[model samples]
Target: MRTAWLAERRSRSPAAHKTMDKIVTLLAKELRIQPRQAQVTLELLDGGNTVPFIARYRKERTGSLDEEQIRQVEARAQYLRNLEKRRAEILQSVAGQGKLTPGLEQQLQQATKMQELEDLYLPYRPKKQTKARLARQKGLEPLAGCIVLQQDTKETPAALGAAFVDPGKDVPDAAAAWQGALWIVAEDIADEASLRALARKTLWDGARLTAELMTDERAGKDFLLYKEY
Candidate 1:
């Protein structure tokens, strides 16, 4: 509970959360509990006061959580604070772009992950070459929409797609028109908040951690340490 709470608090970030997670792992190792289970206890133990003070004064309640564990918890807590700070910066950047819609804002607030936020921001974030941008330059948005609504019971997709193909607008064919529309639909589905939430739930609950030694690099000779996340 403690570890998970801290992790949830830090989930919006990448670099900082990653550092914090490592510290949490160290704390867990010191305390002899799995990292998944230690985060909550570490959070609770570090909720208030200094490490020296906590170690000296609150030993009995924390299962004798020692100086090392206290240090690990404090380091993890500081990293989490940094993650929140960076998240604010990222949000401000996105907002400044004038592309932050209400739905996008809602997703940003509810996102449990930096990767998901990045993915959600991909459409709005500046990029040089994309199919939609090129298609729009060729003036294909309306034609695309026409094909997208082709499934309407009142009008056929092919008929609607055919009706809007302005040769002057560079709409090459019904296929090209619908292809652009399909791109939009795919991005919308990928960035949907509900879809993201379900996927995140699966990642948190279904994923398992694995690790291996760093034998080929700088630590090849060191029996002292080798680890993976």
Candidate 2:
């Protein structure tokens, strides 16, 4: 039984390898340990060993990591496993919709965090009746694609937008069509994983917080220290 399990594990798919590599990297960075230690500890955990048992009896396997460290590893490993499971479900969902492209599949395969995977899948996920969906319903997707491509810089937006005016679709004029196209473009930008990640990193690296009292009446209360900016 153990031999077959080992053989099956050795034949893990590429997606599993990617997930494991990300988990190992995260564990090493978060625990301040080597990747080999993280990998060994994860393997032991996956082999049905309890944290206490592994920390006490399997010290040599985990480089003498204590119970606390083993617990942390177990928690992080479970979270990563959940993340990978979500990724697989998302991939299967997207593929079932017949909308999964190579680029999208690659992004899904490489996503280490749930947030990143969800961000990448946002555009593909089923959403309520949003402005972007309404705009697409009006047959403005081709115009939106043109705006994204930005190939015809010589043509003004109004001039390009004039071509998509279909009264039957409720697109009355160039301005309304342009506005709908802008909605699609905005949603596309918001759904871009790389851009969202960069924006989040920038905000965290440079953001500052300021607090102030709501009014003078509350100034003399227990929040006196927060009265001024």
Candidate 3:
């Protein structure tokens, strides 16, 4: 039976095997159990055994793991499976866009959390018909790049934008070019995942919540206790 299970596991795709190993290792470390314990529990769970049934009847197989431990393993295994699914989808999406480099693919594969994967993929994600798209349509991306590079050029941003002023492209004047460039720059800034993550952390760690009473009489009566405290 063990040999058959091992053969079946070997027949699975390499990625599936990798995900299984990762889940087993992570579960063992997090639950402070032996790897054999986590592995057998996962096998039992995968075989459609109920947590209660396993805890009640499969003590020998599970190394005597309790219901709570088995439940935690089940829940964590589900979450890890879902996370792996999302990771594969993101990798395929980025590859489809022709933007998946080795470094990026490695980062995506190594990301242990959903937020990390999302943050890394933010800049490559498709956007709506946004200001950046409109600006790119007007051929202002180069100007945006120049602004970002901040190279040693005698020409100011407005002066550089003046060269891109083409009425045919709807950029009638330097001002229009500058505006489009600024929009592109703003979109790039918004898409910067690290900056967004830093901002989120700062606000979450330092920001305070305040509650205000409504001016309505019913609101005052409903939140009477909050009015003073």
For each of the candidates, give the backbone clash count. Answer: 5, 0, 0
lDDT against true structure, model 3: 0.88
Residue-level lDDT tens digits of model 3 in 145-224: 88798889988867898999999989999899988988999988877767878988999999987776768758578786
Those runs of model 1 whose alpha carbons end farther than 4 Å from true positions after fitting are 1-65, 101-112, 142-151, 197-229
- Best candidate, TM-score: 3
Model 1 lDDT tens row, 1-229:
5566556776656765665676566557755756754565465554545677667876665566677776766665565455455566667878898777887788776654556666666556667776767677766666656544654457666765666566677666777667776665565566565677688899999998876765665655554343554
In terms of lDDT, the poorest run of 10 residues in model 2 is 211-220
- Model 1 TM-score is 0.50
Candidate 2 steric clashes: 0
Candidate 2 vs. truth: CA RMSD? 4.4
What value of lDDT does candidate 1 attain over all alpha carbons? 0.64
Q: What lDDT is reached at residue 208 by model 3?
A: 81
